[model samples]
Target chain A: MVAAGPNRIDPYLIPALDGVAYGLLVFVAASGLVFCFGVANILNLAHGMLYAIGGYTAAALLDGGWASLALALAVGVLAAAAAGVLLAGLLTPVATGNHLTQALLTFGVALAGGSLLVAGFGPDDPRVRVPAALDGSVVVAGHRYAAYRLVFIVVAAVISAALYLVVRRTRAGMLVRAAVDDPEMVACMGVSPTRIRAGVLAAAGALAGAAGVLGAPIIGPGTDTADTVLLLSLVVVVLGGLGSMAGTLLAALAIGEIQTLGVALLPSAAPFLLFAAMAAVLAVRARGLATRWRTT
Target chain B: MRNEVIRWGRGGVAALVLVGLVVAPWVVDDYTTAILARTLALALVGVSVALLTGVAGMPTLGQTAPYAAGAYACAVLGSRISDVGVVQVAVAAGAGAALAALTVPLVVHARGVIVLMITLAVGELVVTVLGRWRSVTGGTDGLAGIPAVRPFWGLPVLATDQARYLYTLVVAATLVGAVLLLLRTRAGLLLRAGRDDETRLRASGHRVPLLVSGAHVAAGAIAGAAGSLLVVAQQYISPADFGFDTSALLLLGVVIGGTASVGGALVGAALVIAARDWLFGVLPGHAPLVLGALFVATVYLLPSGVDRARLRPRPTDVPPVHPDRPAVREHAGAAPELRT
Candidate 1:
């Protein structure tokens, strides 16, 4: 894997770290989509718009310097969650077990939201100002890397761990999983599947929002950012198998590496490597990498 | 006797529409004529979407990939070869079919949302490659100055806007007629049956994937021909012309026209094109917003599409079988009989 140079460590380490960070960002964004699909049975095509909204909010708020970076991130995430809940409310009436309707409706919402953002923020790319505490680089094995990236990696890892625990160990998480497996049975058991779906959608929105806020610096926020992120998230979610968290994580990491390393190694062919990987994976396993959520 | 009269009436209406299209350039302004030609070209794309998503039940957002391939093929071939407009269209169809063949294997087994995502990924990949390969596609600038199309036969070239409009009208109508005929065939029935129940189709010993692949190839050919016509109309081809937005718009047109009816495709395409042109002219920056709102409203309020509104109750009209309903068994222990 090493290049034919004395200073090969930086070249290898940079892409490796970059890939991990990018993967973690993708997982953060896609985890919400997976949860929404699994629990709510709603494939929210507008999830990307939520990410962009969050990034734009963070970009706007963080510039004020009235609160700390953590507070700004919280506000951004909360705003996104609120927006998600509102969207969920609007869409619930129309969802009605029709995947095509849900897809089209959400796609319309994405287009509207994207256009609104463009109208508000203009078409220029917006950059989020990283806090001074995480602005500098740190030496790792004699190679300096962005401190914000390390923070993103650690924060995303912690979030992943917490998500796993919440889904596996909590009663609410159990209910969500049960609801995903069979909404009718859950409803029969006196659980309001609609409420659970709304809550899960909100949580997913929060995660996407948080990802947007943290990842804004890396990916940058622009008019087309939502569509780009949505495409990547779709790739991740499909490869990971619609409702499988583990599948999403594994797929996100694998795709992240492919994207970064592929770009690094072959710039011209990099754009196609992600789709090629997906095609190859689907060829071997038509249902994707996981078969746990095959019911839908 | 009544059925024959109805059929003749339908044929007469089609003939009138064809006549109107042929005379549109003279009746309308040059700008409207251009828009009419564009709408016809786009309506051809809607027909392809109708065949795939409406008839075969394979929803794809990647139809733009094949469309782009066809446009690029036409542009390159038209630039290189002389006096072969019909041949250029054939080559473009071949390019689209080749792309469909390449991607169908990856997408055929997946259903619903997975199919949408995989196709979208395929489209993005194509667009990315086209954007990067600047030497051929001209990157973002796109391929311009395409040679004027030469009409077939040892005849003079078609130079007037009216001539171009008539040519495009004839081509689009022929393709639409072909699609309508195809839909009445046994293979078309099998394709629709496969959409309702792939397992049953497979049990009956039909190759579902092969049928789907064939539908996709047909769609590609139609879209390719449309792209070729578009190039001939505008004399330019660009990546922006065949992006995700275009795919979404085409799908919207298909849904609006009513997926089940052949005429719906043309109606939907015309509505979308007219609405887009008018909205862009009126709102300028907010056309997408209006378009988006239209999509949402159409999905919510007009689920069966404009065709349902225009359709009148007839004695021959039978209630569609709900595909979601399980087949009933004759006995409690016996296997359920196939519904159809």
Candidate 2:
């Protein structure tokens, strides 16, 4: 392992940087899922489609300029938020149902929505055009990395800080925490649980939409993009111990590194790495994690 | 009198279905027969899904891992080791069970949706490995041109669609019957009890985790055997056959069948698989739309999943049967039921 010495470290520097950006991308995408699941207790399987909504919006609307980027973000967030509202409406009838029913309903929505998207966009991976300013790669540690990817580090940091502030410092955040802790009590307090559910989903959708737009260049808009993002987000949510923001960020970053740096380091085991890491982390965190979530 | 009449009616329906299955290959066209054969394999996978999801109280979309394991194991070893269907089925079952056992720790710790996510990972892992292990799985295009299988030693190799369909039907029926019989045993009772209340089951000196693990392994074996049937039925195998869509369809089929009913799962799975094939053939690009719409509709129509009251009453919180109080249990006997 030490045979390659300091030269080995130089080649891995780019993937490590990419890992940070990728990890943050995952954290941004997954926090929405964490929000929905934690606050609303609804496993919105259509969460992926919401992200895809943003991705396809980016693909169709972006024409390689700052104005286009701003336009894409606004439209993407609005569109995804609207879709989230629609999902909440669909979920009303089965709102009190079991996980199986909820999962089935949302999964159905994802399937139907994803297909409709393909039909609309045509069954092909759409090209994502970055803004002119971020079009080229930047050299880092004598290696080149996409400038757009590096942008996620700054963008995601701002998003996370803003999210933390909103959740920690605001009345809405307190209500959300209360809803997660005890919805029946929240209902008793005259705050309609329905409104709360809708609001949480909308906010979650907005987060996913933003992630989709920004992460499009790296992950891109495609037939497979929704599923890939959904799977990674799911892994992050689980490994993050369900609802803790800090845990999710850590998990996402770890996954990003595993996906990038780990793969670079152990090229032969690339296929097995993502899930293998998931299984290993899950196993180690097994009973402790399960019981902890139950109490929460 | 009503219960007696219902039992007789159910038996009559079973007889009719059995006779119909026996006569199907003769009545159907070759193309339809082949599809039916493949559907039978999938229906068998649905049975396993139901076993875990409905009976074991572990919602899962991961049976495809074991199913793929069994299918690949059979595909790779069938020619070199043995082409006899029974031999391959055993090999496949072992592979599936082993995979399930290895994964039991990751699974048994959690309940409900967590299990679903974990199993999904297991399935995705297998698919990823299968896709990359190109030398073995032939990559994404899948392993094709697997030879026709023999049902048993000294039996003729199944060549025609009619022969393959009949073989699949018989094997599926046997495995399903075995599952039905198993559910009528003490193990089944413990499994049901564990699902209903793990705390109570544990209090009653039952090992809930062990029961979950056993049911998981048993279901994996059942799924594995189904995988072998798939290879024979299609004479071709691909990763697409075991995709997330397949798992979703199978799980929904189990729900349609009433989660606790083995017979329901098999019938429900068969109906779903046939529906997909028919939909694809008839509607082209609209297959997913139709199926997805059906899922949404089903959720609204049958929230608790197809008349569980009729198939198996939600067993009320019966006091745990203490080991020494077999006499008391006899009087309160919910007794092992054959839902099939």
Best by lDDT: 2
Q: If you assessed candidate 1 against the hidden native complex, which CAPRI class would it receive?
A: acceptable
Which model scores highest in DockQ? 2
Give the runs in model 1 whose Cα sits over 4 Å from its true position: A1-9, A64-68, A287-296, B1-20, B306-340
Residue-level lDDT of model 1, residues A154-250, one tens digit each, is 9999999899899999999888888878788889999887788789989988999999888888777888888778878877887887677898999
Clashes in predicted model 2: 0
Name the docking class for model 2.
acceptable
- Which residue ranges in model 2 land beyond 4 Å of their true spot? A1-8, A95-97, B306-340
Error of 1 at A88 (Å): 1.5
Candidate 1, after superposition: displacement of residue B30 in Å?
Answer: 3.2
Clashing pairs in 1: none
**In DockQ, how does model 1 score against the reference complex?**
0.36
Per-model TM-score on C-alpha atoms: 0.89, 0.92
